[model samples]
Target: MRTLAYSLDVRFKPLFEVMGSLHAYICRKSHKKLDLSPSWAQQVQQRITPELSDLLDGIGIDGDWKLTYLLVHLCPGEDAADFVEWLKGMAAGDLYELMSPYSNLFPAHMGDFRDRTVRLFQQWNEQYMQHVDPEIIERLHVEAMKRKQALPASDPFAFVDETTNGLQFAPMNELKQIILMPQYHFQPINVVSYFGKVTLCHYAARIYLGDEDFLTPHEYRMIRSVAEKSRLKILKYLRQGPRSFIEIVRHMELSKGITHDHISKLRNAGLLTAHFEGETLTAYSLRTGALEQIHSKIMGYIEQGMA
Candidate 1:
């Protein structure tokens, strides 16, 4: 799971870093109101990974294997109370339907979904059973049982009964708060596309505006320049939300010395910010929102140097 988590950081950081840069530029140019809530942003960022993995590992099973696993797990006679409880807790309303006779329901797609669903489940279960450590699975089962016995009915951990309503038990309080945050207060836009544009303009400057001696075409392709790689690596972890330097090192397999140096440079360059939750270092992605605007303006200066 940590490997998958690291993979996510490596894959998406560059893009999100771009998002950050674009955000900064837009705020400055449009002079549009930006929330730029640092603490809230950090909180949301922290939740990105563990939640994502839970959804993927649990309900995102392959068609055939997962289907059979669901049938046996959810059906009337084949009931595993503990498994059902685990499913209920892990299955976000977005991912699965937790009505009686548990099932994984995704939004409609064209074609025969029934057979495809079955096959997907089968493959998922085979892989899951193969990949997930037995001890971990057993531990989850054990813990679930313990919680079931000890906790009260209203306690979030108790999944003894399932609810048909789309709302599932939120694993964390912060998540519940976020879900309940007023969408009516916020503007409606395609978030993915919005973030995408922010990323493009952010990186465009890094790739296109730098001095030729300092940043070559090959470095652009490989994202190999110290600043460039730092930029890429930082963004990847950030796409999953902000991470501390320690988390970044663990995920990127970067030496502490190099990681510290890169983070400091980025901080100086105004691409990253560190927030301490008590003594623990929590870094927030600042390149988005207002910081992106500064990046664009700075890049204009860099472009002038190139010229």
Candidate 2:
């Protein structure tokens, strides 16, 4: 068996959240395909600042998904000037090599795209840096570090393992250094590519904006995962006992594709677990106490607001 050693670097940076939230906003405005809730769309739109809007206009929203990843990978600590300088220093070849995997999604003009993206980052830093709270960032970083250190011994992968079901990768003994970034925009978890020896994993932070307003990224995912009627029904069935995929489809009276999608959403949210009994038979069971834990958090959040 091949073992992959990993370490964590937890950071509370505004650039990551700003870029991510901006990309999410663009995705909503463009009606681009995203697996996010309509409620979140409304919240994000309300949170959008005038400066952010202008920045978006200057940068444009095309290929935002690609740009978001690039920004996270190239983030230069917390300094805005250094970040822009880093972007400016990159050679076209380096940019191309970094972004080539997403060539099909980006425009054919690589040089133009690189220049536009660098300008966008510069504009964002200049326009939005005032809104970033150093105190909040420090608090978030402390909380995130605590969360990372508190992961159960049985699961070394932590939130990554929980969200990805299990980490599946091509067998290699490469030293993987995982940087855990706390993001306010990207809910649950988002993974950037395997860049040399480093992998960037962006996880949602539990940001308490006010007594009444809190951002729980994982909770949002869980709520969204069970929102659909079909998905809710599937969860209900799974709560009874473990069921095979075929059995679930038959019981739900839904098409194979549809049932699979619902099951996948639940599984991805860590609400369900899959066990392969054999080469052919796979059974899925409700992740015990998962929903209850989420419920407690939600209720506590609500009660605190009431107080």
Point to the candidate with the largest lDDT. Answer: 2
- Whole-structure CA lDDT of model 1: 0.33
Off by over 4 Å in 2: 1-12, 29-64, 94-107, 132-136, 151-154, 158-177, 188-198, 212-229, 236-251, 255-285, 294-307
lDDT of 1 at 3: 13
TM-scores vs. true structure, each candidate = 0.24, 0.61
Cα lDDT tens digits for candidate 1, 1-307? 0111000000111112222322332233222222223343334335445533343334332343333332332333212332334433443342344322233343354123333333333333343223433443343334334433543434331121111101112122122111011011011110111111011001111112224564333223222213466657676677776676778888878799988766654543434444422223456554443244445555766898999
Tell me each candidate's RMSD, in Å, in order: 21.4, 6.9
* Model 2 agreement with the true structure over 1-307: per-residue lDDT tens digits: 2233555455556666666665555555532223455676665445556665655655553455445565556666665566668777777677667666434354566567666666666765565444555655666567666766764433543344453442323222453566666665444434344444555556545454534435355566677776788887877888898788999999999999988878767765768765521112267877756677678878988898899
For candidate 2, the clash count comes to 0
Clashes (candidate 1): 31
Worst 10 residues of 2 by lDDT: 163-172
Residue 302's C-alpha lDDT in candidate 1? Answer: 86
| Steric clashes per prediction | 31, 0
